[model samples]
Target: MTVTASDAHSAVQTLTQSSDTLFLLLGAIMVFLMHAGFAFLEVGTVRNKNQVNALVKILADFGVSAVAYFFIGYWVAYDVTFFADANTLSQGNGYELVKFFFLVTFAAAIPAIVSGGIAERARFYPIMLATFLTVALIYPLFEGMIWNGNFGLQAWFEAKYGAGFHDFAGSVVVHGVGGWIALIAVLFLGMRNGRVKAGKHTNFAPSNIPFLALGAWILSVGWFGFNVMSAQAVNGISGLVAMNSLMAMVGGILAALVAGKNDPGFIHNGPLAGLVAVCAGSDLMHPLGALFTGLVAGAMFVFVFTYLQNKTQIDDVLGVWPLHGLCGAWGGIAAGIFGSEALWGLGGVSLTVQVMGTLLGIVVAVAGAFIVYGALRLTIGLRLSEEEEYRGADLTVHRISSTSND
Candidate 1:
């Protein structure tokens, strides 16, 4: 028995492919768990009467998102289809399958983010329809433009600014777009009933602080894979990405503590804001730059959340606009600034392109959100009946409660 050099080389190639597949599989699992974070976060934030609805909505949205992505969204974004036989699909040790699983979690987050904004008063089926359309058409169009180079947008950015718009992960592409869309949905849905009366706003206290904190913790822990494993190739992983993520997380926590005046809700969500702001630049910015970006995002969340709730009268339940929309936009632009040679970064970004791309994302998100939610509002209606609102969504929609009183 003898083994040739060519055989040895083939074996090594197979080994590397298997390792890459395994690494991505782990990343996908971690990201899938973030939906649990989304569910629990909404559950703890809404009133007790609506907790069950929150849990049910997140799970249902994920299922719908998976279907949407599998049938149409994936093809729209990547020009790839899964219509081949098992042997063809199983090539690369089924890495594409896991990759789809990974990316679908991101697409599903569109609805999850919107869920937090409009929780407690939305109809179940209407929201489901919105999630399907978003994942199927709206989100994927932009995703294709940015990630897959579908529309020559990246080429235009590169030609104009000497670098393409750089969202190493999906800061502007995923989180920013979701956040902006959620804001529109919240606005179109209007404020929660009795939230304000005669120029006085009432406090809607969280149903369970512990669950909110747990949600934040889960998201924070899983974000390492979210950011670091974005490399998608084992050899491309970097320790710097991990270090920057850590620095940003702590930075967000401290800044939110000071800005929110030690409010537990803000404290828990602070790390998330930081993580959101750091995702775009984690591969390029210095850790200190990432820390600064996180600090700004934390303070921004605290201040903007207060202003929107009190002054503008937008009842964004989890402050999704400030947390994901504003911070994610900031992350996109920050990558350009902090990723420049002048800022001690790796220097492969263009500030002009970043600003342009971020603004484009926001515009697309706002338009899509209004079109979808507005159409729903005018046609079938977006919110529940006044009686349902007072009775609570869990009982009205799900006919159940988080606690089994019966």
Candidate 2:
């Protein structure tokens, strides 16, 4: 059999497509595992009585997010839908389907972040409703604006500031937005019962330090895939992203160790703070710049979390606002500063554009949280009853406890 030039070209194209498809599928699987990290993180932090609820919420939220994003969020963000026949959808080795899977994991993270803040007090079904609304509508709106360039916001930034906002991996888009929205839900839910007693915060130590550490470890391991695979194609992968992520993680660990006075919770969360900050600039930063970004984020999380717990009535359990919200914002700004040739980074990021884009993400997050959580609060209420709260969500919501012995 003689092979023609056209046949040869077609064969190469097919090979390339298949490779890219496999790469993206592996990345999506890695990200899916992060949901277990979320579950265990919440489970370890909340009281023992609420542990089961924490586990249940993360899995349920992911399920809900999958449905919402598949049906609505993907269309909103990319103007693509899965309504086509299987054969049509399976084109390109089903790369588009895996891309959606990878992205939906990110979408699901918003509700998981909120779950930590409002744990032990929030009703289950109402939280699910908020999860559906956020994934299907609110989150995808900003996601489209920044990632898909759907709303012309990126173009406006480029025209005005010399460069568009450059969040290579969504420091502001995913972590920042999720963190700020979690803040709104925390506020609406108020402090957990007996969290504060006459202006002094009560000590609610983690239920299981080992579980907390395990969760942190899982998230840290999976984050490599999260940042490195954002490129989404075999040709676009970079070892620089992996290196920067590593330096930032260490920087965060060391900084949190020093600043947090050797507290285990702070130590565990330090790497996450660094990872969140570095996501925006991992592809463009010098390792030193990434290290500094992580250092700042790690220290900032300790200080801000301590202040919010001690000085304010904001009962942000697990400190999502500090870890994700504020650090995520700093990451957006840091990308502009660090991702410049003058600063030993790859150039093409603008400080003005980064600031503007970060603020826009925060605004969208805050507004969306208010609209979703506020409506839930006013209509069906957002919290468990006083009796239910004392009993814990496990018994009240799930009809079980973390331990059978109880």
Write down the lDDT of every candidate, Cα atoms only.
0.92, 0.92
**Model 2, which residues run further than 4 Å from truth?**
none
Query: What tens-digit string does per-residue lDDT give for candidate 2 at 1-102?
Result: 999999999999999999998888888888889889988888888899999999999999999999999999989999999988999999989889889988
Please give the clash total of every predicted structure, in order. 0, 0
**Could you tell me the TM-score of candidate 2?**
0.99
The TM-scores of all predictions, comma-separated, are 0.99, 0.99
lDDT of 1 by residue, 338-369 (tens): 99889899998999899999999999999998
Q: Give the TM-score of candidate 1.
A: 0.99
Each prediction's RMSD to truth: 0.9, 0.9
Give the runs in model 1 whose Cα sits over 4 Å from its true position.
Answer: none
